[model samples]
Target: MNAHEIVAAVSSRRASAVEIVRATLDRIAAAKALNAVVTVDSERSLSDAATIDRRLQLGESIPLAGVPVVIKDNIWVDGWRVTQGSRLFADFVAPCDAIAVERLKKAGAVVVGMGATSEFACKGVTTSLLFGSARHPLDPDLTPGGSSGGPATAVAADLVPLAIGTDAGGSSRRPPAHVGIVGFKPSYGAIPYGPGFAEPFFGISVIAPIARNVADAALAFEAMAGPDARDSDSALVESSDVDSSDLRVAFSPKLGLDTPVDPAISERLEVVVEHLAKTGLRSVRRDPVWPPGATEEALMPLQHGGLAELYGAAFQKDPEQFDPDVARQIERGLSLRGVDVIAALGASSAITTAFAEFFREFDLLLAPTVPCVAWPLAQLGPKVIGGKEVSPRVHAAFTPFVNHARLPAITIPCGCDGNGLPFGIQIIARRGRDRLLLRAATRIEDEIRALPH
Candidate 1:
């Protein structure tokens, strides 16, 4: 059941919130063998649920009254461990809740526990000193994908109907696509990260939802979105009804990026595009009008800047303690000069303008969420995909430009690769157009679900 349904059932006394929380705790236990949860605070979670029940018994109307939600370890949840998926901060419990989390709690959602994230969410793989590694629920040996891998994996494995994760890059979406679930990374700053950090990622980190399906994702986002006085970047978007008619979309097999996608996966995605074609929303096979060097511009520099900023202090404390790749990333990012930073901003702005114009002709842009099918867990950073050597960051480059543009984008479970790993197709829209994007995505989602496996 979705978060709403579960809460509805509980509120109506059909089932107890205690019962739902117990089932979720049990699911996490069964999934403990998969190593998906970094911390399972059953005692605290149940106590929170008991309070929620008390409110319901008093006849208070709460939005997420009985829903249990998991938060990524990087996000602050008062009194819960906020490890940021690193041993460095393993014992660090938050003293306050982030604004996004506070909003959810105010609306009556129960916080389950801190979900695992990559160390500071710097890398694509989810592992830290606090928790070993977050394994894919579908196949324990493979990655659930990262840095929100734990949130994605747990939701996919049904530990929770909803989870909140952060996406500076594609951490939230990539994991869900890999796990055959749903993820929504709203335009950057759609939800605030206040009560922690001076400014995260120069405004790249978005508090996003990893959900079982699109509606739950939307509901979670709705509860968490809106401007908080603490976060100046959060925009004011008035809620409006969503409709399906009169939409135009452009799709790229590969967005001119030299991706090493498996032919079988590509074929499966083509089938998905064809399924959407049946909906009569105009589909244009126009070439991508992305700015020159956009693919390259979005990749290395940001990765370097992000890593350098996230782990530079770690390198100072003990160089040998850091991952080699992470160490190199810090070195590269720290050395970036003013000109390159200026050029990156220019490049990002140009690409945003180009796509903004492109969207004037198309309501949405559709593309493969990632280039390749889910491969061996041991092979991510080393393997050759799309016939070119792919490092971990390049796999995430396509999704971050939207961060730069602050556009809303969602990853929908489109189909399965031949190996049966999930393939998600991304649906992107203009800034602050999250509700519309979700409505359009739901149309395709309904169709995708109807297809025989």
Candidate 2:
């Protein structure tokens, strides 16, 4: 069940918070070998659940009363020992909660535990020197996707129905695509960032949610999103809504670049588009290029700077103690000069602006969440999929740009590829247009039947 169902189920007395919490603990225990979780504080969660039961018995109401939830280990929650999946701060217990976690708790979500992540979420794989690696629950030999993979893997394995994760560069989106769940990142800063941390130098990551499906993701998004004194970059409240019908989409199997796309993904994407076409939704072929409208190929250089800015504090504390991979990323980020950063920032702006007119013409942009299904677990990155050794990070291309531009994008599980790995179709909307993205996502899911590869 999604969070809403979980909340309602516990509320109507069809079940108790203890029942939901118990099942989650069992699933987490059974999946212990997966290592998708770095920590599972079962005792604390049950104690919180008992408190919820007392509230329900007193007829007191809470929005998400009795809901069991998990948060990516990166974000802070009081006493959670927020690891961010790196050993640098491995011993740090947050003095307070991240704005998103605090909101969830305020809405009555019982904090079940925390999810695993790639070291500092710098790499694409969910492996770190700190907590080993997070493997796919379905096939341990394959990847569970990165950054947010731990939380998503937990959700997909039925460990918990809702999880709060952060997506800087497809951390939230691609993981769900890999694990066959829905990951939704609202326009950046929608859920607010922190009193402890601030925005990255470049707009590359945000606190987001992963759930069993789009609707549940949206509900969680709603519960967590809003202006907070801490996150000034959050979208301003406006009178707008997601539409129910008459959607316009730009479907690109490959996002206009001749990358090595798996045949399975290419074929499955077409079927999804074909189904959408049946609903009278206009579909077009447009190259929604990354870096938006910038003429230079500069995502990596610019992203590195942001990486350093976000995790620089850790670097100062214990640079050598950090994950070697994460330290490497910081070194690369710190090496960038002012001119390089300025050029890259300009390129990002051009890219963001280029999409302005495109978004006006298209209500939603549709593409495979990743160019291909999950790669082998042992591989560091794709060796050669479509005749090119694409950056492992770029395989999950559909999401990062949205994060960089701070736009709302959601991935809905349309169908699976031949390898049995899930391939998702991403729906993007204007900045702050989360409702529209959610609506189109639901329509596509309802319309598309499972197409066997």
lDDT of each: 0.77, 0.77
lDDT of 2 at 156: 88
Backbone clashes, candidate 1: 2
How many clashes does each candidate structure show, in the order listed?
2, 4
RMSD values, in order shown = 2.0, 2.4
Give model 1's TM-score versus the native structure: 0.94
For model 2, what is the C-alpha lDDT against the true structure? 0.77
Candidate 2: which stretches are off by over 4 Å? Answer: 198-201, 237-244, 289-297, 307-320, 450-453
Model 1 lDDT per residue over 1-453, tens place: 898798689879897787888888888887787667778788988988888888889998878877888899888888888877666676888899999888888777888767777777777777665577788887877877688988888888888899998887788888888888889998877787678643236656788998988988988888888887887888766455755578878887775565677565577767777877875755777645777777654445666776677777877788766655456767888899867767777777877787688777877888888766555565444266667776665666557777767788999988786677787888888887788899888888898787765
In terms of TM-score, the best-performing candidate is 1
Question: Per-prediction TM-score, please?
Answer: 0.94, 0.93
Q: How far in Å is the alpha carbon of 113 misplaced in model 1?
A: 1.8
Off by over 4 Å in 1: 198-200, 296-299, 306-311, 387-389
lDDT of 2 by residue, 289-391 (tens): 5443443246667666777877767787778777777677788888888898887777767667767767878778887788777777766566666556776
